[model samples]
Target: MEKQTPTLESSSQPQLKLAYLRPGDMIDVEFASATKVRTKLQLVGFDTGRYLLLKQPNPRTEGSYADVLFEGNPVIVRLVLEGEAGECIAFKTKIRAVTNFPFRLLYLDYPEQVENRALRAQKRVRTHIPVDVTADNNQADNTKKLASGVIVDISSAGCRILFKAQNEGGNVTHMNIKVSIGSGSQKDLLMLSGQVMNQKKERGMISVGVRFTDEEAHIIEVFDHLLIDTEFEC
Candidate 1:
């Protein structure tokens, strides 16, 4: 799908953290903020401190790919790495002006600065399953007990749970809740420290926005797929 040139500051643009990119990594690239069709490209090689060679994502049109790249012109790119979909990086860059017999690929100028920001509309899904929450992982708090809640919505980074309105104690704001979500064998029991970013009370129902804290990247990756594929069935 094409993307609208984000109507935000350049600072919020995607910034490539070299740590996330490698020679073989692939990135979705868009041209000129005027078009939304992003081209998938592979990082075939780089000239270290100079330029980068990328395998074009689309077929060569009637015109030369080099002409389309608009050598020396600025370009924008998006990267949705693993489960970090909550945080996508869209940046502006330029393809170098050099045109030689690389034969089948295009070379780009090394990004001096790529603005990194969240996606225009982050990937979040509605979950109809109930999620069990243990406010305190410590079983010692038999008195405090698990707070039963239904997961109303979920994202790659966190979930929103609908719970009893009375549980809006101040302590629940950043409480570490062991959330058990999903159904049947596909169910997953995970320990997530919840950051209650928002809370709403209506009709005796309390919906709390909980951001899962300190989850390992790999775990988030697994959750992202499940939330998208299983829970949301998308």
Candidate 2:
């Protein structure tokens, strides 16, 4: 795609806002100059308002561009947009600020598998989840160790989770988990085993997708309840 740079005058600053954003949705932004600005924008810290820090590339964008560059860094952006209609509209002026509406995080309302089966002929559900991951190699030892990860999404057959690398060799195949669900009185925790199916890198993090083993039917049943009974009011 052709990149463009924004024309910023001394008195006027570029207005920036996050338009059409959702919690799990991916977005792309560009400058008016057609320079194809590249940076890692994180939904990191949020106050009553949504604030973002643009981790500018080293060496920075030079010249009389947006006073965007300060102390060898790009100006941090504070964005606020609404979650309604799956859009977060943003604009900028001299003092950069997001417009349109206030931004809120979104969670999928329905099961991803159901949505996928209806939309694609292949009937595959591929969604990413954020998790804390780890691995252990001493299976024969008496110690019972566990790796922790959050269930990103669940289907009738499989699930995906994010986790930290347990070993340097990257030869993880089998794993055990103790998953805690709900909170307080209704909270439930279960132990299960699964086989790692794939691994990929995202935003400098390693994510592992797993398929539950045959012996873990009970764990799958609990997932079914969580996916079906929970009413997500996004």
Candidate 3:
């Protein structure tokens, strides 16, 4: 439906092309509007040198997708892609055709790809350290559970971690985090309240994107340690 196609700009649309996109890469679609309704979709395949065939989208019922992305309509959509190094890139595309034969897909022909490197607000240092984190939930009677995870990458602003935890009816939203930075006697735990910024679930694991609400000095201290340690290990 509408959630998959790119929304066209009535003013001026740039020429965007991404020669690197491949099938199975995840993308987030956004409508080109004031609200910019967003939805998730996956690349199914491409029509050789013609267009990209995306898995049919689940459109929101309230958007202007019907008026814009209909047959023969040159609609523009903003696509968000994450690089292998975890950088996000946004591309603007025009939908050429909607097909049903072969498989359900929306064909995206040519695109004007662009990126704002400033979106990554901080310098990221990749690290591998088992971090023990625990947070109390106000919704759960102030009770919290400890979760063990590995800090994948960290910055002064936040850190990304992969964790496996059992959620009680998806009650894994908010918590006051105590992030144990290191292991053994070298371990230093930072007490910070945080909320889940973004998360992706796989099996029983959740990869959490956490934005620290802690003091800047505390997070910077951890980031400094990670940078020094990672450089030494390298």
Candidate 4:
């Protein structure tokens, strides 16, 4: 059975609206079958109002999903939107074709409509605050993967950062967030631990959503600064 989703404007709850998705966006695909197979696919390309083209998952890692990916097979597609628009978008469609000539690809019928659900609990305020993020991949090793970015929007619960990927050769998906509040002698280094919730990469820049863990007290001042800055800007 397919999951029923309400329209964006029909409910006062978190609205799910169609977002302008990019080519490399990652989306989850769930088949409406007995096994109910689910997998992740990258958006290769698409024809507006016609169909969506997705890169088929690697056969070695995903096994051969040939049977489950047949034509006319129903599938549910879900994707997350980070940044200021924090929500999840879902739609139901059927596989139209699968090709493996130049590259393996899965074609899906265009959905008539899509449903979105808000993912953020607290509202976020927009701001630009420089911060350094460090990714500790191995606890036993001393190797540190560091990247510098600015917090674009934030709340007490979570925040979004925009930055250029460092040559450190790994994604800062789950990293420790270090933010500097003041300048010079009065500078306050607020260290907050967080897990990367969602990330989007476009061009050479990346946007990531991070949820703080047990750092409400440390973020109060930062949040207050953002609130005041927002008020001043308005």
List TM-scores for all candidates, in order. Answer: 0.41, 0.33, 0.62, 0.79
For candidate 2, what is the lDDT?
0.37
Tell me how far the alpha carbon of residue 153 in candidate 2 is from the true structure, in angstroms, after superposition: 2.1
In model 4, the clashing pairs are: 16-116
The sequence of per-residue lDDT tens digits that candidate 3 reaches over residues 21-118 is: 65665667654433445666687766545676676665554433554444554444444333213444455656677765676577776454454332
**Which residues of candidate 1, in runs, are more than 4 Å off?**
1-9, 12-16, 33-37, 47-49, 57-67, 82-86, 97-102, 118-234
- Maximum-TM-score candidate: 4
Please state the error at residue 204 of candidate 3 in Å: 7.9
**CA lDDT of each prediction against the hidden true structure:** 0.60, 0.37, 0.58, 0.71
What is residue 64's positional error in candidate 1, in angstroms? 6.1
- Clash statistics: count for each candidate: 11, 28, 11, 1
Worst 10 residues of 2 by lDDT: 108-117
Sequence-dependent TM-score of model 3: 0.62
lDDT of 2 at 40: 32
For model 4, state the Cα shift of residue 189 in Å.
3.4
Over 4 Å off, model 4: 1-19, 135-145, 183-185, 225-234
Better of 1 and 4 by lDDT: 4
Candidate 3, residue 143: the lDDT equals: 48
Better of 3 and 4 by lDDT: 4
lDDT of 4 at 203: 78
TM-score of 1: 0.41
